[model samples]
Target: MQETAVNVLHPLKTAALAAMLVLATGWSAVAATPPDQLLVGMNMNNVLTLDPASATGNDVVPVAANLYDYVVELDLHDPTQVRPGIAESWSIADDRRSIVFRIRSGVKFHLGNPLTAEDVAWSLARTLKINRALASPWKAYGFSAANVERSIEATDASTLTIHLPRPTDPRLVLYTLATSIGAVVLDRKTVLAHEHNGDHGAQWLTTHSAGSGAYALARWRPEDVMLLTRFDGYWRGPAKLRAVVLRHIPESQSLRLMIDRNDLDVAMGMSAPDLNALRHDPNVAVETVASGSMYYVALSMSDPKFADRRVREAIRNLIDYDGINRTIMPNYGVFHQRPVQSALPASLPDPGYALNVAAARKLLAEAGFPDGFKTTIRVLADPPFMNIATSLQSTLAQAGIQAEVLSGTGNQVYGAMRNRDFQIVVGRGGGGMEPDPYSNLRALVYNPDNAASAKLTNFQGWRTSFSDPQINRLIERAERERDGAEQIRLYQQVQQRYDADVGPIFPISQMTNTVVLAKDVHGYFVSPAWTTRLRDVYKQR
Candidate 1:
């Protein structure tokens, strides 16, 4: 790959630029900003709204995390370890039917209201009220619209208790709380103040935030920029950086240019080519960590040919996993077909599907498409997936299956997937919010309640209308199983069954997401869930 010009953030650049501006104009210019600021570049289009209840993509996780606090949170460095947030300590009942938290005292929302148990209860209620987006995962935990008021209660000023509708493991309850939007606390007084027509301020929250986090929202102009300022009164000390500015630049080369010129601090959401070109630049430190998401080709089982089990197996064999991982996804992806990410337990190894054109052709003939047929694939207009989709198109053609690739933003692509509007599509999405098997198993495979009311989540199974009553029974049994050993055994059984019958073609797990930053910046690591925290991050300057 050709090398790119990448440089560290120059401490004197602000002054130098200011001097030039002063020289150009007759009047004096504003003083240069202090070096204690961070500018992040990413595809901010995924963040259409900041309402934690409605946040759908991990693309906005880092941003939302800065402005909100969860009752319990996943340890950023290690998701398996649950950590405290607004709630300093928590305890579960002996019967495993209720959990109570001791809300941290003196923690103030950005609006100046001190943290209270009511805020904690109201936050979860808000997501339940919205009945969409991040609220979808709660249904698996026994949360439903009808049980909202009865299930959640603020017992005291600093005590919040939740009663489960069904018996569940305490770990499962904490796991859900650690999600990006799951246990997020909202200011009850502030949100209620903006309520109109029983909307619970869902409309107002789309553009504003009312939380007690390290940083607070300043302004957000969709598709342009989101500006945030440090909250000095944060319960967990103030942020090291004074401000965080997120710029929306879809072009990878443009982001690289900004990094090269020291105009940007960190550049995320860049393509593989742009990142590969910066690998050797001394001033640019690229941090890549394996993520919890998978890249796969989802087939609409509604298609008569795809409905055949033989055809689905043959399509799996047609993928060039080794070739794609070695050449196309170096430093960014790993071959993984198991529904769950390897970091989590019960995730099985690849079932050994090699690229065999003849075998695929035979399977195609068995499915009644002897000579193959034409189809279309929807894909995000970004790297790796788009490039991989093109490769798939080539491989499928060899088996006499002609395919056309359509490119668009994630909303356009995934929207089609959710609507079940396409025959096939190269997509990337899965549950990685917590370090557990069910988050992925339930979202990608189990769909016993796959109905219009359950569309709150983008469970791929719903799109294909795939469900197995046996698998659903196992999933619930596993959730209710309290014994650690027994729980693992049950989840592994769920994985085994899913691999044998599921129609989606999960080819690889994204190995690492690259976040390029100036070498002097510290405390930014690749996220397990594609998210980062700015509280500990600081510039050498």
Candidate 2:
């Protein structure tokens, strides 16, 4: 099959075309997107790097899913269930200290190199050696550069074994393997050939790909466009589409207009207003799925004001959860006040926290701030963050507290939070991509260290300088609990304790991702873990 390059119109050119069409024909032009190709539109600001070991944001999940393959995959409808991928099957050791995988035969990488167990072993070992952002989960599970070589190994061409260095639920390790981008198997030979200095191909893999997946990297221009061509020798059948082109069109209005005119097939990251407007259109279909993440308001406990439990409770009371979910979060998120995503059986129901100005004032008075105090709220300049910050500003004023909204890019807002420099922040994050309570707790609540020099930036609890021995004990105990029922109970207890202790991070809502697709598109189901695959997506006309 011959590969085709799909032309993506520049945003300005698209607007000019619309204006010309309106003036000439009294209507906009409806250009049919190519039947053999898929065009996606979304904001690419967060897609800073494509190297799986370093990629840290949701924007890179779907891209990496199509470019590489994992040993196992989480079921689309039920993430708790694991499905076989590169590894045909795997078995846990009798003592639950190791897992052995049986690598499949005849799998070929995009570069035509044969896939082997050595590739799987090297890929995971490299992830630890690099020790970047994506290595957090592995490090949490006691895997490190010093022990990774001995802990993970290929016994033969078709067999790989991974030994655990600590006591923890083996299932959590499997879940991490199934969902984490770092676990994607790389073509070791191809990658090492491109290695520069002692970087181990870290620099080359940023803009390139060497995997046994449905698509191969064709061209990538950060903040502009990415093109992927179908890999004919993919272990699975070749992708239905000849090529997939992802365009970076940050403006929601432009995406709305393009999809309306049939110039684009799929649009993501659209504003709620545009999604609501497209709901009644017959040619377009608006779909939503529960994303395993939360929208939260975090406070830095290092600040003397927030260190007081009474003041922390007062700030939590000032949030208008119901109003925000009902109005501002219509298409953005749903009301959820717990750290864990609501889909998990281990998760508890919302604790019914509403805007209580009177209660907030009383708590403030008890905390010796009868007149309230002034603070700044750091938030992303995007849709829901800014909107949530504005709502918080209004409610806080009612409680006599003055707050200024500080808006910036993801790096600006999150960087300040990571450095323990922000007073308050309206952000959306928690490692709920995997369907496990521990994933959420480890990211939001489990802080093993509280010292400034520890720099556990990956853990939100550490970032906020909030640590409780009781909460930490519960999280650790829950992870090691072998009894299913007891594990659930422990997770529930952690949430209850967090509420009573007035933890700094307060979850306001659970995220629900919405996408606008042309009606003719089929087999485009969104993954709750953000690993949406495009191998089977095709256009009818």
Candidate 3:
């Protein structure tokens, strides 16, 4: 009665009613609109270098990680897990040496060109050609004289395959390929257009960017500030915030004051003490993530002052990791109780090495350096390690060693360390999407084949002549093993050997960084391994 006979049996009316229902469903399909603005601050100046292959420094990696995307992505929620990013899917040959990948559909570079397999081939070739100055995470996948053949070829527009001389394990694919430094896919046509200008990976991409990432560099000045804006043309949904602004605040106290005043939305590379103070404020939020990195003293193996094993052991024993953690690092980090060979979570047999003065002295005496030698230690001007370095110098002095502490900017410190200009240098090393022992170990151990190997602790240019046949064999086997369990085992063995040898690195601490952001931010995840993914991160209303 209320429906007034319900317009009974009218087919046209029924059709109209159905059409209205369909319209409502379509309306619900619309996506939520993104935010208007997003901002962040940093304690130190970011290099603001856009070239992923050559970008170095703690501040630079966090920014490039989000502004750039790789073909394969390591799952943030699960450090060991991985998913496809630019490439849709991949498969290995029967021998497991060659891999064929089917490019994802609808992917486009920042320049609006569709992504193709030829771009993949070009990207790999570019990385091999440049062999970037920065030690990338991908160098571990057996990128040797043999692996440098640019073995990549595009079978077709969407199909690409890479032929490895030896059968590579499937698990080794992502570990060796998923690097922050190498092969960030670009538009083949855009690169070709610039090829005549002598620009390719790092050298070409430095001032500009052309990846399919969430944002693009809108503006950048080396010593000033850099700006990033959401890529409206992104194949993935547009980022929530309209833009990201990176300020270069070289002074820690100034940065702290800025954040406290609410002038900064987020800050990058905050020191442990300043971070702790921010976390205590009720109005501010602090987020600490385990940085997938390890800081060590790089001994000049080629230097005459540190040439003896006794001297190196003496230096290692002289470091007071426990005291440093209590004072400098405070609540922000753990005393490197375990000798960190590789950053693998489970691979560490123990959290750190014990401070054994007796063992250290014995080793020193055996090497004919019972009276300890005099040397200098170089370090960054940053405060987090200022107290630690001073303590190290004092401890070495007690051992009849003259330890002169020299402070300088990051660039100066890096240059000194690379050229073996100092007897010992305090530095941190870890990068790329995946943290492999190869990444950490290679930096400390010199590999004759690696171009960067000369700068690493293992290089012939450095002091310690420490070598282990078992470790070398394991490194070769680990590179070949595709099976996860076997690979882990091989790495564990490497760790054990490293522990026994107790070479150049006297690893003292593994840091837990507190990262603070506005409550409206989403997709922020930090791994204990110290990996931060900027791609999936966005702001919410």
Candidate 4:
């Protein structure tokens, strides 16, 4: 909920508050935090890049979430819906292209500069300009380096306006803005001052932070540790915790041991068995929540023989969802078919695609594979991905299809799929972390453009050259629909239409993030994106 001022605070009022604070605490800014703070365990080895424009991994999302604020944000209570953040209020025009945002007055960066429309415009321009690997998620929304500078502009200091080339679904724009990349509003003065030889202060940002948020980046040493201190002038108020320490203890056993000894407050990144054991410990609490991410088995449409519609339907029928959900994913996952989770709007029913060996065999026979055929599917090097692959192999063997499971690192597996060097593969990814269903569908299933222009690295449908003229039209229509209810109806129609064709991918589960923390710790939701800012957490004391 927003707490509005009667009007902008007068300069004298701000000065009086500061004077009162100094008189009461003998400090000008804030009281010093106690030495002991909340410690959170997470992996930071992959966090080399600090520029939000170039950030594309889970490693940097949590870091940026605390270090910056976007124009709008997703509500903590209902993440799929929109909430106001830095921009206290905003409005859209009748033409639908012009979006006017009013900056929250009196907000200051951690480095002591007021946030303004200039900073918001500059940061967005930077993201579009650096549109490389980092801009992958928004690429589907038709945003590109070629057009962003002309589209997003600041009308004045307090009024920032964005002009789209065409009507973009309002929720799509808002939800997209709520993400890490869209929220990277830096301190214009501080960042510009640190600019070295046109680096846009990227070199400095890798080690220092210049933004306004609940926490400030205190220290960052690659592969070691990252610490965040509560912002002395945080707009909301002081954070509950004194500080948040993300220690890079690589081993799950080391994390477990440290938390058990009270040297740490959380033990993250552990395997299911480790968590299962920890759940029984009197001092530990394991919590699991459904996430937007999904795992699926996708077939390569480039394989002409496998192109038969019957083959696709048969593969969907052959998957033993019950077997996998019960044995392999007790705490890690839940059955899911739609690209988006049920938590979001317009999620279609499961379509009741279940295990039916007889039906699968019948389809295979119709497709001239009565005797069954051998095929190969790729999976990540991890045990879970491999376990799911092996299980599928056994089930497929029942229908006379001899399947081989190739294992390797995620890059290796996804690379093979992207390169079209594999027949089929089991993969996990969904909105990168945003729960926006349009974003997920665009990346996973929509491919109106040809493979060359598809930027198919993350587009699973394009990875297999799976395309449909009808699906593309429906996607475009849904992207421009103004009414939310109409948009949901269009999306549901798209989902059912694609399912009717037995789309190249068969979704098996919606990933459930399972985290284990100390019993006395009160932490916020561990989002589907697998990143959470620790400002809302505290120790019971």
Predicted model with the maximum lDDT: 2
For model 1, how does the per-residue alpha-carbon lDDT over 1-541 read when each residue is reduced to its tens digit?
2211221111224564344333222111323223677778888777877778887777878777778887887787788888987778988898999998898888888878888998888888778878886777777777887887779889888998989888777786788787657468888898899898998888888788887888877656677666677788888788888777777788999889878877778888787788888998998898887776778878877677677888887788778887788778875677787777786666667777678999999988988888989998899887788888988899989999899999998778888877777788887767767678877777778777656566634677887667778888998898888787888899888878877884565656555677898877888766676547788888884
lDDT of 3 by residue, 244-363 (tens): 666666666766776665555566567766777877777557776565555666676556646666666666777777777778775446566433433464356553444556666677
Question: If the candidates were sorted by their TM-score against the true structure, best first, what order would they fall in?
Answer: 2, 1, 4, 3
* Model 4 vs. true fold: TM: 0.87
Worst 10 residues of 4 by lDDT: 3-12
Q: Please, what is the whole-model Cα lDDT of each candidate in the order they appear?
A: 0.76, 0.87, 0.61, 0.74
Per-residue alpha-carbon lDDT of candidate 2 for residues 1-541, written as tens digits (9 for 90 to 100): 2222332211124454344323222223446776877778889888877788888888899999999999899897788999998989999987889999999999988777899999999999999999987888899999999999999999999999999998888898888888899999998998999899989898878777778788877667678777777777777888998777788889999999989787788999999888999999999999998877889999999999999999999999999998899889988998899998886879898899988989999999999999999999999998889999999999999988999999998889999999999999999889977789999899999999999999999999999999999999999999889889999999999999999999999999889988899999999988888889999999896
Cα shift from native, residue 437, model 1 (Å)? 0.4
Strongest candidate by TM-score: 2
Q: Roughly what TM-score does model 2 have, to 2 decimal places?
A: 0.94
Over the stretch 162-267, how does candidate 4's per-residue lDDT look in tens digits?
7876667666677767875645688888878879988777776666777788787655556666666677687887688656667776677777776676666766
Q: Give candidate 1 misplaced runs (Cα > 4 Å).
A: 1-33, 449-457
TM-score of each: 0.90, 0.94, 0.82, 0.87
In candidate 1, clashing pairs total 1
